[model samples]
Structure formats: C-alpha cells, structure tokens
Target: MPQLILSPWFFILVVSWVIFLTIIPSKVMNFYFNNEPETASTHKPKTHAWDWTWH
Candidate 1:
C-alpha cells in the first residue's frame, strides 16, 4: 500500500524472517538437547547394543 509499507524489499523480507526465527531454532534445539541420551547407545555395548547370549 504505502509503497509496500516503505519497501527496500519489504525491509529485507522482514529482516530475513527475523534472522530465520532467531538463528535456526536455537541452533537446532541446542544440538538436539546436547546428545548422549538414548540410554547412551544402549548402556554401552559396542556402542549400540550387542553382547549376545549363547554358549
């Protein structure tokens, strides 16, 4: 309307979507809640659940 609300590419596309919602969703949720939480890869058995049973 009023020159597209005083353009300049509409205030640089609203400050680039407000810095893409304030910097990429808090750095992707702080690296997905700072990892190491899937039972630390199944209570550490060769990194991801192993230790079979048979003998």
Candidate 2:
C-alpha cells in the first residue's frame, strides 16, 4: 500500500463513506416514513445562517 493510503484524511473519508452507506439510509427513511401519515408536520426546521468568519 502507498504511504498516502494510510493517511488520516483517507481514513476519515473511508469512515464517512461507511457510515453514510450503512447508517444514514435507515435514519433518513425512518424520518420520511414516520412523517408520511401526518397532515401537519411535528418536526421544526432550524434556521441556519452562515457566518462570514467561517468563509
């Protein structure tokens, strides 16, 4: 294996992909499925404003 293959960023990318594929689907599906029956949604959306300092 190449030295770059063992880097922290690579590990983070792989871990993120694994979690995205294995875990995120069920959670997202459950959210939509649980909300399907409701005429009024119980979940509230948060207002997110970007800080110029981060940019």
The C-alpha lDDT values of all candidates are 0.75, 0.81
- lDDT tens digits by residue: candidate 1, 1-55: 6665666887898999998999988887776454465534455445567677774
Per-prediction RMSD in angstroms? 9.1, 15.1
Q: lDDT of model 1 at residue 48?
A: 64
Candidates' TM-scores?
0.27, 0.44
Runs of candidate 1 with Cα error greater than 4 angstroms are 1-9, 16-18, 21-24, 31-55
Off by over 4 Å in 2: 1-6, 32-55
What is the Å distance of residue 11 in model 1 from its true position?
1.3
Which has the greatest lDDT? 2
User: In candidate 2, residue 6 scores what lDDT?
Assistant: 61
